[model samples]
Target: MSARFTRPGAGTPVPVRFPRIVREALDNGLRIWTIPYGAIPVATTTLVIARGTGDDPADRHGLASLTGDLLDEGAGDLDAIGVAEAFARLGTHLDIDVGPDAMTMSSAGLARQIERTLELLASVVRQPRLEAADFARIRELRVNRLRQLSRSAGTVADRAYVSAVFGDHAYGHGALGTTRALEATTVDDVRGFWAGHIGPAVATLIVVGDVVAVDVAAAARRVFDAWDATIGSSRIDRPVVAPDRRIHLVDRPGAAQSELRIGHLAPGRSTEDYHALVVLNAVLGGQFTSRINRRLREEQGITYGAHTSFDFRRAAGSFACETSVQSDATAGAVRDVIAELGRMREAAIAPEELAAASASLTRGYVRNFETAGQVARAATQLAVHGLPDDTFDRFVPAIEAIGADQVLDVARRHIRPDEATVVVVGDATVTAEALTAIDRPLQASAPEF
Candidate 1:
């Protein structure tokens, strides 16, 4: 590490320190990124492919998910049972996770097992069998999860909100996809999806804890040298923000309380307004004393709790306030929530409120990387979003730099009280009538499908 950067807080107003990940690229264009943390005997490695559900073929909404799950069933010469035993014998923890926008294959173990682990990773990504038997089992498991989600009103509200907000955008599809899509997805489709999406051009390797930077880089190169770099989705365009201001009421009979999700599209983590928006969100609905929570829950006694947040994805994400309250109180609670949003958008946040929110945000920023795993995860997120190299190092200072005016400015620009998507999951007949009687200027639309 350079000495100047080493004394991070000793100089600049917004001091920063990059994590010092060694970087290289093989002939195949697979960029290798590594961070060597030699303080412990254990190490973690993660290979993140840019392709996720966002890259799903329109007809095959569940291909990415199926591919992610089947990668661990068997690879190279190992069958499903053999792969399980190998990881178990090595005492390694391996995880495969698929999202709408990306997939991650990660593993952690003693430093001595790096070679074996790397080989396992390569095998899984390079030569998964995607056997018919394993596909049946995975599909069955996903069906069960979907079935469980069907009975949960909260789950129903959440899924409906995203689908309503994003429409046909890549993010519109849920991570656990529809049962019909899963049934239609085939092994060849999984292979083709991986070939197109999981390769070097879209790959980021993060290695942390008890490893030399050079060795980590070399390991990455050895394993990923032949992988394709420009292998993912080609249709990259700025997704249109529909910003439909409507009340989507999901009718679930016998629901005790209405589940609600409100608010609209906000800038992502990469936006220049990101820092200000963070503070603004914290003041409005991000904390216990936040205005939305205080007004809706503490003051009005409409619900036990209510809060707002921004999803902050690689692409545009949702900023939403969510809570559940008695069915009768749903209309009142949502109305109050909107009034608060309008108040926040128009008013200059009081100095005291900004101070407290800033304090909470600063405190949260400090605690964000309390664990090694968290630190690694943060790095992965930063890499994925193409954020500045010094995000973590400058996190606290960034929060401290935003004044009341800056926060209010961001709130005014992004917190759209008039355009927020208010979704309520309850008996539509009761809630719809209540909304009609309230007669607010905001228009309401019924849920379809």
Candidate 2:
């Protein structure tokens, strides 16, 4: 007799509990958060300062990014090569990133090397050698990179879209400053920025993996307690998004395909309806099987793929639908994208779709804490966004509680199809006829970069 086995049905998801994160503050106002995870004999440290490109002076855009890149180039007694060798010899890695809101420096190494890594991180943060030679070299590379990006259809569309939507707002420009702005930056400007923004008063240190909260706190105190506390300027004004919708066409002559960017300003991460809006975005275009991708790519074969997302920031963010389609199909793709946006607000999502979207969110929530570094980063984000410590704990529950009605309600309230700024980057001569069919007056311009 032969025995057969049956395939298992979908099983209930196991509940995930995040590790306890202890928060403390040093005498110099440096915030420290330690999360203990002993699964591996390794540790990770991340130091986040509440300064980024948003703090770039009005005339000196991209200064913050340049400052961040120069951190590990040299420090107290180490030159650029020496800094690299120091981490290499210890089998560790230090990475730095600057965003619109904050600059983060992170490292991972063996648990025993935690103290040395923290000391090196402290030097990079507090005593970076922003030498004139280093500044000149980095600035040239950035300018060249910007020039290269200016030629890309996608890059042109992105810059043009934000410029059109935000106008004179600080967020109008990309983090990589314009060629003119990058050329204008000086070493003194960088030093001044570091003095004013990168300090203990506006910084947070996070340590995770194979460490105790008390021990991590003591280590942080040893490294950062004596640092100066110079508070930077207050946050800039929230971007003022105008309610007018316009179709801007960037002339990228002889382009093979048209890059389409359609979006409008949306709520920040702290919105009361964040969970509902997230679920709504899923059904619209947040997932591969979303309506936008399904209709544009799978059904009509207009393009390979289409998607949408909310760029959630501390203040207001934007909801964008991005895709590339044949020049002749640009207008049709735009029409279909707008139609899907409308349907999300007007139609009730099917039960299966809602269940699938909710499941996708809740199921993936556990993966965020799979590593000590990931958990530390998540906690740091919560701190950066001023969210409650329990935010992660409540994430799954909040997503699961979202009903179809709530999705529709949030969609109706947030997704404004009429107010979206439509940007197209392609050969204007070839796409003009198809694009003008949308019934809106087309505004033509060159790439702002």
Span of 10 residues, lowest total lDDT, candidate 1: 7-16
* Per-model TM-score on C-alpha atoms: 0.91, 0.96
Residue 24 displacement (Å), model 2? 1.7
Q: Write the per-residue lDDT of candidate 1 for residues 1-449, one digit (tens) a residue.
A: 77977733322233335457677777775656666654678877788877778877777776788789888899889998898888878798679888755688888788778777887887788788888888888888987888888778888778878877787888777777887777777777877777777776777777777777778777767877766534745553446867777777778767778999888877666789888888888888898989888998888887889999988777777889999988888899988989988888686888778778777766545455544465678777866777766777877788888888887788788888788887888877667788666544334433322
Candidate-wise lDDT, in order: 0.76, 0.85
Q: Could you tell me the TM-score of candidate 2?
A: 0.96
Q: Write the per-residue lDDT of candidate 2 for residues 250-297, one digit (tens) a residue.
A: 887888899999988888888898899889888889889899999999
Best by TM-score: 2
Off by over 4 Å in 1: 1-18, 228-232, 439-449
Among the numbered candidates, top lDDT falls to 2
How many pairs collide in each candidate, listed in order?
A: 6, 0
Candidate 2 has its poorest 10 consecutive residues by lDDT at: 1-10
Error of 2 at 167 (Å): 2.2
Distance (Å) between predicted and true CA of 383, model 1?
A: 1.8
